[model samples]
Each structure stands twice: as C-alpha cells, then as structure tokens.
Target: MTAIAVGLVCLLVLGLGLVVHVFGRVFEGDTRPTLTNDIVVGTWRGADDCTFTFNADGTFVARNVPVSLFNPPGTTAPADVARGEWELTAAIEDPGGRLATVQLGFETVGEQGQVGIHFSTRLRSNTVDGEPVLYWFNGDPDLNRRFILEKD
Candidate 1:
C-alpha cells in the first residue's frame, strides 16, 4: 500500500526473522545435557567424618552420622551409625539432561528397632577440580550441613 506502511512491515518482518533465528540456534545446539548413574553408585566420605557406602543392592551404610539429626541441640548421643536402603527415587534435570536435583529415599533403623524413612535430602552430581563428587544434604535443620563425598 503506502511507502511508509511497506517500510514498517519490512522492518517488523526482519525483526521477527532475527528473533526466530536466535531461538532456533538455541534449540538446535545440544538442548539436552547428559546424565549418568555411573559414579553415583559408590562409597563417599562426608566432611563431617561420616562414611556413606551406596551398594548396588539398593542398600547403604552410614557411619558416624551426626547426632543432631535426632537429638536436641547440645545433646550428644552415642555412636551414630545407620544402616539403610537408598533408591534413586527421582531426578530432576534441565532441558539438557543435566541434573538439577536428585531425590534419594533413605530408610534407617533406630536402636529401638524403629525404621525411619527420610525423603528430605537432595543430591547433586557434580565435579570439583576434576574430582567426581556426590553432594547431598545432611544433619538436622538447625545444623544445615551439606556433605560432599568423593568416590573411594
């Protein structure tokens, strides 16, 4: 129609094309990140002097766990060793398959022969300085401890 209208229309089309090109490039290049359970099934030591061994049999052993998880603040309990079972319940990932957070189901038996299942912890599979690490939450809410375990 009019020259001015034609110019405006052309500009709009160019802008739209540019946006589409950029978005297409974003989607075209590796949208999904790779995630594996390769190094996740192993033993790792926590910074709090705890040892967690995740076995292929879906069982796990935690030694020297902090007593604050069950006891009140400033209350110390005896040796904290827990035998439990773990399952890769859920894994949330980004569009690239990179793990955002992993959900692990942990069930431990208390000394009184009571079984407790904890589902509040979250794990992140990552590497620090080229060393593989499995990071997870530990300790009580007040303590707010984070455990980073290296494959042993």
Candidate 2:
C-alpha cells in the first residue's frame, strides 16, 4: 500500500515536471539583440568577400555578394556589386521590440538598358562574442545554416 502511494506521487511529480518544461519553452522571451540606426550605420563583411556598407542616409552598397543571396538556390551568375536602400524594423510583432531586422532593397539594372529589378533581403540582428552581428538563413532556417556578417 505504501509503495503504491509512493509510485503515484512520483508519477504526479513527473507529470508536473513535464508540463513545466514545455510551458517554459513556449513562454520564453526573445533573446536576440535589437538593431537600431546607429548600430547599423556602418560596414559589415561576410564570407566570400561579401561586404555591406550602410550609410546614415539609408543608402547602402553591397559588393562580392554570393549569387545565392540575390537568387535562392543561386543557379545564376553572381552579381559583382549592387547599390540599394535599407530599412530596419522589428522582426516580430512584439510591442516590446525585442528583435529587429534589416531589410535591403536591391536595385539591379537589367541588360540592354532595361528597367532595374528590385528585390529585398532581410537580416536578423544577433550578438556573437559580445559584438553585434547580422545574419540570415542560407537555406531552410530549420537547417540552422546562417550567412553571418560581422562589423568591420
């Protein structure tokens, strides 16, 4: 009888522990760093000699960017350089503004005097080695492969 009561108590404790663990993860706050104009108005560099220069006036220059960035799956020839405008905004709908994103609008001029094609990419802000860095998913975000840019 005593062993039965102890077993039941153990089961109850285990059940409560499971609920706490699940709820803790579900309700955890966003820990990513927030981006601001002052933090982003500078230069950032990534692998393959990719560089992003952000200006105070919201203008930007990107050079040596991988074709994958301009076109997903990256089958086309690489764009050597591009000029564009940039904007920063919250990454989520949180009123506290915990996470932020930098959106780059690329203005690519087509061949033979054709009109320019406009596309945009978004980078989320994070901290690495206690320094702010910008990054975006290289492929499926669930795969956890990131193309990160560090301040220069």
Candidate 3:
C-alpha cells in the first residue's frame, strides 16, 4: 500500500533505535550494583559454589558449592552442588528498576535437581552476619575487584 507504510516506518525507527541503544548502555553507569537486604549469613564468589543465609523475619538460604570447570584429562572431577531456599524480593521490576536484592529459590545440591529455583542473581556490597563475611561483586568491567568481604 505505500510500500507497506514505508516498511512499517522503517521498523518503527529501527525498534526505537534499539531501545535507545540498550537504554544508553545500562544507564551510562554510576550506580548499577545491587543486592543487600540486611547481611544474612553469607558467602559467594566463584571457582565453585557459594553460600548465603538469612534470618530475622525475612528468611533466606543459598548454596552453590560445586566445581566443574574442565575435565577429560583423566576424568576425575565434577561435583555440582547447588542448594537453595530464598525469599527476599524487596521490590524488583527489571529493565533495571527497583531492584533491591531478589532471590527466589527451591533448588537442590545434588546432581540434576529441580523443583523450582528461578535464577535472578545480582549482588554486591560485601555483607556480614556471623563475622564470617562474604563479598559479591561481578561488575566485570572493573577488574580492579576490591568490593570484598572476608571470613567464610
């Protein structure tokens, strides 16, 4: 009809300029680090599974103590532990909005697990509870890596 309405207005201006260029590259930085809902017994990093517990009328528990990076040189390693039990979704909208520390769980630590455990991870700002500290910062681009927590 008119070249299909100018090809649908050039695909709606190229999908609104690709959603405003990925929302301006995630808000052009300054504040994109979340996860901190009252220092619940915690621990998380990498190289294997992690941990985090909470209790103060909120309820929480996390685990991921598994390590399986690479194997086949002799077939001698691959333990995928993945425990879970969380409930602290203060307010998470997404598209990057109102994210306070969302963790919904029902995972398992044994191999091949399931029951419910939707992954919505994101945390940083080292917390403390049992003195056994735990820092979580996967901001990436800031390889400086200093958002730390100790005593796990």
lDDT of each: 0.59, 0.79, 0.45
- In the predicted model 3, the residue pairs found to clash are 49-64, 49-65, 50-64, 82-109
For all candidates, the clash counts are 3, 0, 4
Worst 10 residues of 3 by lDDT: 63-72
Count clashing residue pairs in model 3. 4
Quote the positional error of residue 152 for candidate 2 in Å: 1.1
Question: What C-alpha root-mean-square deviation, in Å, does candidate 3 show against the real structure?
Answer: 15.4
The candidate that wins on lDDT is: 2
Candidate 2, residue 123: how far the Cα is off, in Å: 0.8
Off by over 4 Å in 3: 1-8, 15-17, 24-37, 40-147
Better of 1 and 3 by TM-score: 1
lDDT of 3 at 46: 45
Candidate that beats the other on TM-score, 2 or 3, i.e. the better one: 2
Per-prediction TM-score to the true structure, in the order listed: 0.53, 0.75, 0.23
Q: How should the candidates be ordered by lDDT, best one leading?
A: 2, 1, 3
Tens digit per residue, CA lDDT, model 3, 1-152: 99999999999999999999999987664342344455444444444444445555454454443222211245254434444455444333344454344353435434456434344343323224423233444334267443333424
**Tens digit of lDDT per residue, candidate 2, span 1-152?**
99999999999999999999998996564446777898999899999898889999998877777766766554476566777799987776557766488988888633332436678888887777778888888777899788899999
**Residue 8, model 3, lDDT:** 100
lDDT for residue 143 in candidate 2, whole number 0-100: 95
